[model samples]
Target: MFLEKLASKGVTLAQLPIPVVRNEVERLVLSYAQQRQWFLWQMEPDGSAYNIPTALRFRGQLDLAALQRSFETLIQRHEALRTTIGEEDGQLLQVIHPCQPFELARQAVGTLDEGALQAQVALEVQQPFDLARGPLLRVKLLDLAQEEHVLVLTLHHIVADGWSMPLLIDELVSLYEGYSQGREVALAELPIQYADYAIWQRAWMDAGERERQLAYWMSQLGDDHPVLELPTDRPRPAQQSYRGQRINVDLGEALGLSLKQLVQRQGATAFMLLLASFQVLLHRYSGQADVRVGVPIANRNRVETERLIGFFVNTQVMRAAFDTQLTFSELLAQVRQRALAAQVHQDLPFEQLVDALQPERSLSHSPLFQVMYNHQTRVKGERRSLPGLEVESLPWRVHAAQFDLTLDTFEHEHGFSATLTFATDLFDAATIQQMATHWRNLLQGIVANPDQRVAELPLMDDTDRQHIVDGWNATQADYPGDTSIHQLIEAQVFATPDAPALVFGEHTLTYAQLNRRANQLAHKLREQGVGPDVLVGIAMERSLEMVIGLLGIVKAGGTYVPLDPEYPQDRLSYMFEDSGIPLLLTQSHLRETLPIPAGLRSLDLDGENLEGYSDANPNIDVAPLNLAYVIYTSGSTGRPKGAGNSHQALVNRLWWMQKAYGLDASDSVLQKTPFSFDVSVWEFFWPLMTGARLV
Candidate 1:
């Protein structure tokens, strides 16, 4: 509607006032962006990770001389094209070279097919440029056929960026359109060059602007620098592997329109809505509450720098906290607020942000954020036309990745075209392909129901859901049914009476000896009112007696909770109060440190008098559905949450372990984990029930 109103009033974006920096003098000091590139270039002297190459194809008769003249004039117009980095007095600076005769490398490969042509293009893209020896830009012309030609423009990142690509292309086309017609028409000369703006930027930042923007950034970032832990196919290497490739993704026109409408209804831009959905995807992938994504903002807000060809782009970190309970609309609101705030503070150079925050540096990953999201509207390409020629943009393979993962989306006539560029070392092609599907699926889900919880949003289709819930879990093997955990051990005891069941220090209890001791304690426990479904607590360190106490309680049909003696008193007291245990079995030595509640019946396993109890097996009616044990997990929140498992579940897991690993008499299973964990449950019982030695 606002655009319609502008159209009604005969107002267009091109009519707006656009100021350009017009200075008579230039400065040698490099811009902050150039300085960052220089440092990286020094680190990897032969690395082409920072190279930028774009290609265009012409399918008509091309005047080579006119095109060459066009490039010569365009390169002379922008000093950045001829600029290279050098050092003066131990400080890096930009040195501008004089305008020299242009030489467009011509490669006549008319017989080469499409794939072979791209291979040659990839080689050209990978060629390294010498920053100190000048000529940081390369122009290559490939004569593919009689009436077809391909032009490749490659530049070092220190001189140009994404924004410069279109500007450079438009100027080059316009120059050719005029020169080919024997006309002298040309583009308006820029009032100032990139070097003049670099000087002006230093002066502008010195007038308290840099510190003013820094305040907002410092507050926004604080001490939080979260490393994205997106589960990858492989572990990350110690240093960054710049090797990368791109895969195309297309979200249908309908989904794109629906997403755009949803964004408009929420009073947010497309970037904000898409970024919010991306955060949801990352949170789902990593199960992290906080996500930080780096976005490259064309920091050309100042009209003076918009038309100049230099590395005017700066990265801004978009940091936000996500919650599973947040609705899609609610999450978008937060993203919208953060996006607007970041825009206000976008002038703060990312290089300076890294310098000021001084995060723990690692070569394996990027600082602050390792994933990037970029959105572009390719209206410039559609608007650009060359005289008497059909132009189609050709793609050159990406040989390096600037981040662990980067999503670059372009809005074109066909709705949305996206490509996910990822580090080849960390992820496989299929992982990224599935991620693209998930992201698209998430966006469709979000638009379908904007009020739904972000966590409840669909990231998988029915096929994926079925695969995860049923296909991968096709572990259908037969095992003994209706058997209690103790019954399995009883069968093992009968099969191997002399096998070692429990070992601590030098003392070893064979199956028969261990079962006899446990039976006597079970009988005593039953006499002390320990029966079915009764709660018992065993607080002791790792020892043979600790195992005996738990096994004895289970034999007596009571659920035992293992409490580590090394825990703090406050934690112990909280656990005791939470579980409401009636009986506690501990040792005499640990009684001083135990946080025993009032009216709790206590017995010391070593000090108790169980001599009169029968050594035979106690005929207790323990069912498979009875409560087995309770394990408390200290989760992200400080509170401990107790979860109880049934005997059937435990028995099934142990049976599956026995079937899978086939532990027999020769195997010695080491039980080192404390009894409070589920791993300890299997470590103690799986071996004892399978006639394997428990060490």
Candidate 2:
């Protein structure tokens, strides 16, 4: 219908050679945009983070008119500069506009200062472009002074990528010089345009080629793609804000040299080492072994496509597995292998790969990875000089982020300059600043000792280490040296004799009453040859008598070995044999269920024989370092093992708990945990030492 309207105006649309065949890459991009409802943004637009802003500061005699003419010529040379991306017949189409008068917007900001000029440039970058319209690019020239100027260039990502930035600049320099000299620019003729290459790519990717590349991606990513839940300063909103800022980081010359040397020694490229360091840093922050980072690759592999300006960049997912046992050198080698393999299979568009893998897609976050890494070291030379003008690239913040974090590193004369750009909504400036510092520290530590395990790399400097180790662990206080667990309880007994110390369903015992019961049981056990290094097994239902049995074992200077009666008889028999318990204390009904060791006595606490026992504290001399208990572990992974803990260890922990939580006589602790687990030891001892009631 639009062609018929053009024909009525004496414009033959069919005379033009613009092809309408959909390209594979463009088709996939259109499908993704449609699914996300991004086209609706054309009606109600949001200033997306997809805009690429580049500004060059020039300090010399500048030719504004000649520069503007040069930009117009470059637009005529590249059809992509005059192209619009829109949908026709429910498909993505690149409509090419005929070459016409093009004007670069120029503004004389001679009255404004440097800071004000930068603010104006930022405002220009924040403006959103209508992709469905004719022009998807813009340029502005700000005259800061008579001899100084700032040239700003902005483009939508649908038409251009990072590689195109340098190419565009280099061509602009040549064209500007030619127009200034009033001479014809002698440049080579183009082999094809971006649209032609896109069509060629779709034809090249046959069924066999698609399957071969997809299999590698599927095997590499596997079933699980770990999404990082980075700690954010503010809660994430239901939708992304795309707000972002950048923090500058530099690796000094000495460490940078060491890094290069280390990379050479490991037979890997600088990119692999940097990526390994990044993965290690993420591992330290997230404690996740699986690390995936998005890397944009220059997909212009052919010689013909190298010089053309187009969106030829493809994203490759670089997944690095960080094993604690692997050394930094080993990890670097693994990263190198994965990187090289990805470069080989770089032709697969990231959108297609995502479709093939079918990862759990979400609108709140990116799929597969939440962080991106890119290196622009190869193109630093292109930024040095623009014909006659001394060109210096201006580093400015993009008010948006495509991912949670993006680390862009560029090589320089001194060492390397790294900029960490992160979403402002997810992270504060301070957090990213610390992360930037940590990344540098990690690089320094790994270079200093590449042979060390990756997990052993020091992520913090001396100041941070001091703050964490010394500042947080200032928990020192005076504790008694000659006292044992029983001695502490005895002191509490003297202080609060009438306080309720133990309670179970309707049965309760005061401190004095509980001590007398334990004393009576201690005397009876002492008569049975139970002393220091002796083990007494206590197996009973949870009751007030259970607390008495545990205290009696410690009072008699014997190690208590608790066996849960509900456990299988096989496990109970193993614990008795492992600890070599000399005496078993239980109710009369449980005596038949347990396997009694030879020459070991099984005493029933409910027996009438205990009526003759003395209810006095025993005069036992037990040291603080003596064994307090021998707990047997469940044989889930291997053979069941018995661990012996000392009275000093238990007393120190209970003292720390008292000071940390301020536990006192007013507190009541729940003792529902089974005695077989180590957690139960702290729960059993914490209350008695703090003069708190246990139930």
Candidate 3:
């Protein structure tokens, strides 16, 4: 009955035509339905309830009759205004429907107060529309006073994005002037409608065009997905959400022009200069030589799509490796070539690219890129208001995607302004503030002396560098005396024998108990023909036994190969076999999971026989130069290469930390990182050697 009534009102299935299909258009349609399902939804599938896009403003002493006439002329000039959607063949489609000009509804308010007028306008504009229905747009006007008025326009996302709003505003202004002057408006005929562009896009993509583009992307982003190693103060969430805040950094005209000149001298674009600056900053901040950042590309290569309103944006992962010795100009040249290559291969959709490259999607973040850099040079002209009215525009609501960080750059009249939006859940505001300051200093240094070598660029002022160094300096009276790591550990054990020294899942061991258990393990390894130069595998979970076993292997004059219990059985077996381990220390829980290679002796710390010897501490002597441990990080061949570290290296690190942080028994250091990560080496051993408490 509702369908019949709507049909009688000239809104029938026969009236609309299905829109042309394209990849982005199809994605947009599906995404709209999903958003409606999950987020904002208030209307049913009835054609009567619809949402409209509007721009609201106050117009003082505006003629009501003239405003009505202006709207009628605006509607007549733009065919999009008269277009409506209707159901056809069970799918919603757009139809050009005839309508009696724009209709105006006026309600008289008893009071002439400005606050009352705005309240009424807000109520009307806040009215929800059923986007699933045919009518998905609306406009309202509320008179605050005889001379003051508010204009509100609301529309569904299906019809527009940020790009289309400016177009609508430009046309509306011109139409208003023509209507007020009673003159025939001369407007250029659009070459094609948005639907036409959609059809063309589908045809182009179907002709093997996208496949070639995707091939380029794959080649550029190889197999290695380097992680951005930023130290986190808190445990990271399993997934990142789009909850962020913005920090705007202003680059004055002097600095901006200097940077432009520097890049130009190297025959590069300003983007190259900015990229080099960021790469250098990342290296200094994270102490990493390689960095990867996501760059957004406008993907509107086709002449047809330039004017077409749609979401035609794609992202490219850009990886930069820094050499501290390279000159600024040389780095800029390299960055220029790489950026050009990225632009040439920017056709692949970010989501599709990630899917194709990374088989393991369990990672907490995107494997390709976690940070984004957007350089948007386009800007819309300032809007002119209707006659007898002043207008002001402000963004009311906005939606952003999930990313660790995003830097949006726009060119202002004076210079460039970078608006950095970051996830608050992951980063503190102070960190972002420091990042901004660092970026400014880096850019200013480069701009001042473009010919200087990158190594020569002042990354930080001497005062700041000294401050950082001072914070790391560990020279205080409360600090423990210069003592060997082993001696320090022995002293702690003797001083606090009953204090808990190691805590793993479900098990906590006192220093005395840990020392005795480790000694027992060392004795067992010695009995199994293990000695100096032998690599014993600790194939166990993160438990008290794992820690004891590690110290025991070192104490007994043997290197420990940490075999993560979480690794696949095949990989674990391969590592143990490759390392030629003669003895393996593990708990009973993981015994069944591990493969017992030939000639590999196993000692289960949880077994009954080892329980009796747990209290027997064997004070074995080991040299600092003896092999302490071996860690296997990722390599290009999909195989892990072991980096052997001696006890001397561990001692050097501890000594460096002690000298750096002024460590004392009073300070508590948090042990937060996984043992598999290199950060654990410093977090765990530094405090133990310095007599500082490990929290």
Candidate 4:
């Protein structure tokens, strides 16, 4: 073996035990399996997103043998590379092979096609790994052109995680350099293998530590576990498919600088600012006070575990309670406290914590939380430069999302990039894109105005706000200018004298006849000084006479207060008192029973002596801003309240209804609402205003 060859050259190598203990996370992973095959680590790559693949691009690579030897040395040094998980005595165990010959699959392409190479990498990442068989890791070498070569290393997540990638690459670079220059590679020996850490974790949790930790998590995540109500394009399926896609967004230079300054001012890191902003955004979208996000942590707290490469990554549920009254600065402080506490209690595996918390289990949703937040600080400046090769990390998609949404923020030399991975089954491309835009806008608002409350911060720019407000409500149209409701109706009477304007059952009044009849009533009303500022109570039933009385009051330059005759006598009396009307109009049949106050006089429309009154318009000088009508609220309390609207307000509303619903003379609107309610005012006038019949 290449490692044996290196050993013969006086290089000391560490040997792992034959069968070692599987870690706490490893055992939990085995429990996630649905079948015995999955328990044995026999994963079906098509259904699950468990594999971890990393690609490294190397330019001007000349020594293939030295590179191959470096990989072999890496496997010999780390027991994880030669490790495979299997079942023994009804328990999962990791078995490490003593040694094996190192082999790298070589593919030589004449032309350097980056797209082709990426496609190959994607296909390779999805390939299933046999956990019981050998070779849980694969190294594929692609020689593109002469000097450009790519080394793609794919490993199962059971042995590797995001935090282990850098360590693995750093060790590979050191071993490769030593082999290329024929110099001795002096690397420090690992104090313990991953198996030892696994054993220690199991024993430590079983001892009283787990109960203390579980109690903390239990209290943190209360009994009411609410799912995030993120608006999606499609309804959630009966079961989660884990099918996902990604949207990329960047934090621009200006905002990024401002965020950094804000972070410094708050005595926090950029990560804390990002997380706080993220929680604010989630709260705004979902309207939930308790927000829970799963954040992955590099669980390498001990000095010995820091240098070792294994699945040392753990997830911590970072929960923050948002209140609309809390300022952004206050929310950030709360987020910081929660994040620090979660980091302190990062030892409990996510699986074990789920078991302890015992939240309502659902196959359609993930346990505890559905949103994941991750921040990766890439060390681009500290990247090692090989002797004759230029090495750089290549981006590749490993698998779909395990959660409904995963927000990945990567810090680079210039600024930060945010990627939102959303499930395709639940969300559409445009929805996720809009979400990303809102995320950027939220960060900008936070950095610009950190003292603003989370609920007050603007999530949309001016253009977006305009589109929602002005663009959607762009219903302006020309109507009779400087016209009151009576003048507008009079104008319509002149234009369409014979058109049916008022209809009640089989009775129909033409525009001319309705105008003439209303004028006769108005002439009598003007005799009683029913002019501007005068309110006349029209306590009438739903009939044609009620419509004529309302029109006559408006025609006399006075606003009519609607008093429903069917209401209780006390309520009607309260409404009449609140309105303070000097005159009342009703049918002759109800005049005796109507609750007319002592000083208020009543005129029955059906019994009025209108034969002597002039059937001409009163010609009262009424401005568009004059009060049109007053509607009293039902006396749910002791006293009723009256709300008055001006003729201009009613005209504007009628114009909007005309434009919105396309009301015309052919349309018949039902006017069945009670007269005292505000909606009755619109119902009584909207049909007449737009030449529509009120049924």
User: Which candidate ranks first by lDDT, i.e. highest?
Assistant: 1
Task: List the candidates' TM-scores in order.
Answer: 0.75, 0.71, 0.55, 0.68
Ten-residue stretch with the least lDDT total in model 1: 16-25
- Name the best candidate (by TM-score): 1
Extract clashing residue pairs from model 4. none
- For model 3, residues 533-623, the per-residue Cα lDDT tens digits are 6888877765566666777787677887878888777777778767887778888888778887866777887773665443554555666
* Position 653, candidate 4: lDDT: 82
What are the clashing pairs of model 1?
none
List lDDT for all candidates, in order. 0.85, 0.79, 0.62, 0.78
Among all windows of 10 consecutive residues in model 3, the one with the lowest summed lDDT is 29-38
Q: What does each candidate score in C-alpha RMSD?
A: 7.5, 7.5, 11.7, 8.1
lDDT of 4 at 337: 87
**Model 3 CA lDDT for position 362:** 39
Residue 16, candidate 4: how far off, in angstroms?
20
Query: Rank by lDDT, descending?
Result: 1, 2, 4, 3
46-93 per-residue lDDT for model 4 (tens digits): 544666778888878667888888888888888878887676778777
